[model samples]
Target: MNSHTAFVAAMIAAGMFVLLLGTFYFGNFRRQKPALWRYVADIDRAGAMIRRKEYDEAEALLAPLASKSDAPLHIYQLRAAIAQHKGDWVVAARHWKAARRYFPDDALGFAGGARVLLRAGRRAEAVRMLEGARSRVHNPSQLTKVLAEAAQSAGDWAEGARLWEQVRNEAAGDIDSYVRGHDCLLAAGRPDEAAAVLADGAMRFPRDPQIVRAVAAAAPPGAPGPA
Candidate 1:
């Protein structure tokens, strides 16, 4: 062939080689650079195992990943959840505590740890942890409810009543909180205070049978009618 044609052929081959190299480089960059995608994939896989009720396998898969990365909050959270489900309150508490360390701002992590601590009968510790968490939480009604229950279980009826009242105020129209608050107040031996709480609850939930019953129950047998 002519030298001109040979040169053109060589140029086309070189161009193809450069295109192939570029494609390979980009593929490697996507796979090796950043690395977050692979970590995310492992998290997803562990989540799927959790959904399938394969707690052991899920924990196995997540443990190493959690240890390997700083962003493994979800992994630690899932491990805590699994441990709680398995009735290993101590293990759950440890995992949740680890998760909180990695995500100190995570309300759920602190809440979970508090729950496990309460279940393990570490009421005072749970209260302290939850109280600290409460200040950090933007919306703490649910966590307050949990703390209330924990305090009640630990025979701190007064503290339970206080927590429930706080939860009731934060709920702002939640009938369940009103009902729980009334019950907690009565249990705390503040019957008169319970009566007042119930009266206010009746105003908010006028048609709720539970609220009406709670108010009636809070009153003494010969006490005056609703105030």
Candidate 2:
């Protein structure tokens, strides 16, 4: 063929290829859209069932999703929640680990597993788990907060105070950290540090009744107080 004829033929072929690709892409997306909606609906239904304490029903609803090879993180989380509610610590831990494996960047599984282990009276295990996962977590603040809670539960007042202080410093808007940090420092017999923490919270949350009361009570003997 002539050079001009060859160029025209090549252009026509390219247009046909582009048209075919667009057709296939849209067709597949349309076909998958309903499945995606159904998946979301199922997740919502399972969540409601879990909230109602219907473990069996929630599990049943999630079974199909769980069987899929590409199951999302929430599926494992829901499974872990169900297991935890049923007092199946081993199964719950396994599901949490699976979630962590499936979604490596997320801290939810590590936090959830640690909380469950703590609730099961495995304080050391909970601490160890969080410490081990700390380096891999996308957000260490979440894990740090849970570690602070674990410290409080274990009566490690010094450690709890330090962890709470770290938590409050790393993230803002958590009034619990300030209150708990003060309480922990007091328990550890550091009244000055305790007072400092409470004073900081009072400054940040001037209108909060709890902080106001705490600050008033935390005032040193014979010291001037908030007006």
- What overall lDDT goes with each candidate model? 0.76, 0.84
How large is the C-alpha RMSD of every model relative to the true structure? 11.3, 6.5
Clashing pairs in 1: none
Tens-digit per-residue lDDT, 1-227, candidate 1: 99999999999999999999987876543321234556788878877887898999988887777655334466778888888778888788889878666566657777888888776778778778877887776557767878877877667778888887887778877676677767777877887887777788898788788887776776669977554
User: So what's the TM-score on candidate 2?
Assistant: 0.68
Candidate 2 per-residue lDDT over residues 94-143, each given as its tens digit? 89887776666678889988888888898889889888888897878788
Query: Which model scores highest in TM-score?
Result: 2
104 in model 1: Cα distance from truth in Å? 1.5
Model 1: worst 10 consecutive residues (lDDT sum): 27-36
After superposing candidate 1, which stretches have Cα over 4 Å from the reference? 1-53, 57-75, 173-176, 189-227
